[model samples]
Target: DGRCLKDIHCLELAEFRWTLKQAFGSSQPSARYGHTAAVWPPESEIPGRDKDSEFLFVFGGHSAVSELNDFFAFHIESSTWVKVDTGRQTSGPSKRFAHKWDWSGLKT
Candidate 1:
């Protein structure tokens, strides 16, 4: 009863109700809380990929026993979750929870 969850639900504006999403992927993020998520490249398509899908990025949350800094992306159109590796060269950010995330649509 006290366990965390990785399940995702979506709200349908037209229906005015929430629907549980059936997500699929090779790997899934662990159950977490206090994580931050955001939709990136808003209103644009990811280059070299199909334009129909958008990604939701999730990061930094507390699991049952400890904080986490793992990163992941959920593909909306495909209903898939993909883990993002930061690579061995970089340690990335430390474990954290209850964080905030915002993306500035800055263009160079």
Candidate 2:
């Protein structure tokens, strides 16, 4: 469900199609019925550097419980995924499914 703000419609059908294509490939049904699943709390509100440059990241959701120590950044300009590895074995919050993260900029 998309919320329209101040008479502004926020959902783009074409982008949705593109996203689905990226996730599932070709919009074709999978032979394995449960291969694709929805992520609960479907929104990740990472702040953008500007209108043209932004980072989009996603994590495992309810259907997938694996703790994701690995992440990838999507450079909109290049339209590619850059794998990010946090070499430091720092301990903090455990990786959780259905989690949303906002960019905190670079960590010192």
Candidate 2 lDDT at 61 equals: 29
- Extract clashing residue pairs from model 2: none
Task: Give a tens-digit lDDT track for model 1, residues 1-108.
Answer: 768889998887899999999989987899999999876656543556654556788998999999998999999888899999869425678888998886555461
Off by over 4 Å in 1: 43-51, 106-108
Give the lowest summed-lDDT range of ten residues in model 1: 44-53
Count of clashes, each model: 0, 0
TM-score for each candidate, following the candidate numbering: 0.81, 0.40
- Candidate 1 is scored at a TM of 0.81
How accurate locally, in lDDT, is each candidate? 0.82, 0.35
Report clash pairs, candidate 1: none
